[model samples]
Target: MKIVIQRCSRASVTVEGQVTGEIGTGLMVLVGVTQEDTEKDAKFLADKVAGLRIFEDEDGKMNRSVLEIGGKVLSISQFTLYGDARKGRRPSFIAAARPEQAIGLYEAFNEAVKAHGLEVQTGVFGADMQVELVNSGPVTILLDSRE
Candidate 1:
């Protein structure tokens, strides 16, 4: 499993012109899973993202975790994060996990995060969706569970 986390002042996801998930003052996370990913991978990343200290503290340093600031999470399923285009102009998504396998792990990740007392909103898995976000500080970080 892998994730791209963006510190956002606000974020939302729309599917078929309907808003599905929304949040304010939080992390906009794009989640991906591969065929080799497991439940443990999902749990690991959930813990990491919830605890990562990217928000600034009063002392003017990056010292506060999302949990500390009571931030929400806009978690979006994005298989394209694993797209491979090294061989040609078109990208291949062979490395991405099938929807059946991915949805469970993705839900597990969200559940784990919610268990930490953070609100977790999510986009429709495997749906064509539109995402909007105001990236606070333009801060973005990438994480891979295997690492």
Candidate 2:
């Protein structure tokens, strides 16, 4: 499992010109599942994302978690995170989980985040989506279960 977490002032996802998921003052999470990913990986990453102290406190220090700030989450399924472009010009997605398996884990991840008592919005799995966000502080973090 891999995730790219971007702190955003606001975020939304659109599919076929229809808005799907949207959030304000939260994290935009792009999740990727590999063949080896399991529910445990989903839970671990979700917990980390929820408790991450990237949000600034009153002193302007990055000491508050999203939960503390009453923030939301916009989770999106992104298999390209596993794209292996080390070889030729084309990228290979062999490391990414199949859609059937990925969708389950993706949903599980979102549920895990919601379990933290924070609002969680999501983009449709396997759908062509257009995501828009105002990245707050340009703060971004990358997480990998294997690491």
Candidate 3:
């Protein structure tokens, strides 16, 4: 599993010209599932993201987690994260799991996040989405479960 987490003042997803999911003052998560991903991977990432201390503290230090700031999460499925373009002009998606298998894990990941007691929003899986966000502090983090 891999994710690109961005601190955002607000975020929303649009599919087929219709707004699907949106949030304010939260994190925007571009989630990716690999062929080897499992429920365990989802659980680990959800827990880690919930506890990640990227939000600022009273003293203006990055010491508070998103949960502490009453923030929300906008999770988007992005199978292209696994695109391997190392040796060719075209990107190869062999590392990404097939849609059937990926959907279950993707839903499981979001459910895991919700299970952590946080508000979790999401985009339609396998849809062409237009995501908009006001990146707060422009703070971004990359997470990988393989490690």
Candidate 4:
């Protein structure tokens, strides 16, 4: 599992010109799953994202976790994160997990995040979606379960 976590002032996802998920002062997460990903991986990344301290403190230090600052999460399934382009003009998506396998883990990840007492909004899996976000601090982090 690979997660691209972005601290955002606001974010939303649209499908077929209709807003599907939206948030304010939260994390905009792009979640990717590979063939080896499992339920454990989802749980691990969920815990990490919820606890990650990217937001600023009173002293302007990055000391506040999203959970502490009452932030929401806008999660979108993004299999293309695994795309490999080193060999050709077009990227290869062979490393991405099959939809049958990924959707389960993706839902598990959302559920685990919700269990941490934070609101978790999500875009429809396998849908053609558009995401918009105001990246606060432009702060971003990449998490990999295997690592």
Ranked by TM-score, the better of candidates 2 and 3 is 2
Please give the TM-score that candidate 4 achieves against the real structure: 0.99
Q: Sort every candidate by lDDT, greatest first.
A: 2, 4, 1, 3
Q: Which ranges of candidate 1 are over 4 A from the true structure? A: none
lDDT of 4 by residue, 93-139 (tens): 99999999999999999999999999999999999999999999999
TM-score of each: 0.98, 0.99, 0.98, 0.99
lDDT of 2 by residue, 3-86 (tens): 999999999999999999999999999999999999999999999999999999999999999999999999999999999999
Clashing pairs in 4: none
Candidate 4 regions with alpha-carbon error over 4 angstroms = none
lDDT for each of the candidates? 0.95, 0.97, 0.94, 0.97
**Please, what are the lDDT tens digits per residue for candidate 1 over residues 88-115?**
8999999999999999999999999898
Assess candidate 2 and give its lDDT. 0.97
The alpha-carbon lDDT assigned to residue 77 of candidate 3 equals 98
lDDT of 2 at 15: 96
Clash pairs (backbone) in predicted model 3: none
Q: How do the residues 53-141 of candidate 3 rate in per-residue lDDT, one tens digit apiece?
A: 99999899999888999999999999999999999799999999999999999999899999878999999999999999999998999
Residue-pair clashes per candidate, as listed? 0, 0, 0, 0
The true-versus-predicted C-alpha distance at residue 70 of model 1, in Å, is 1.0
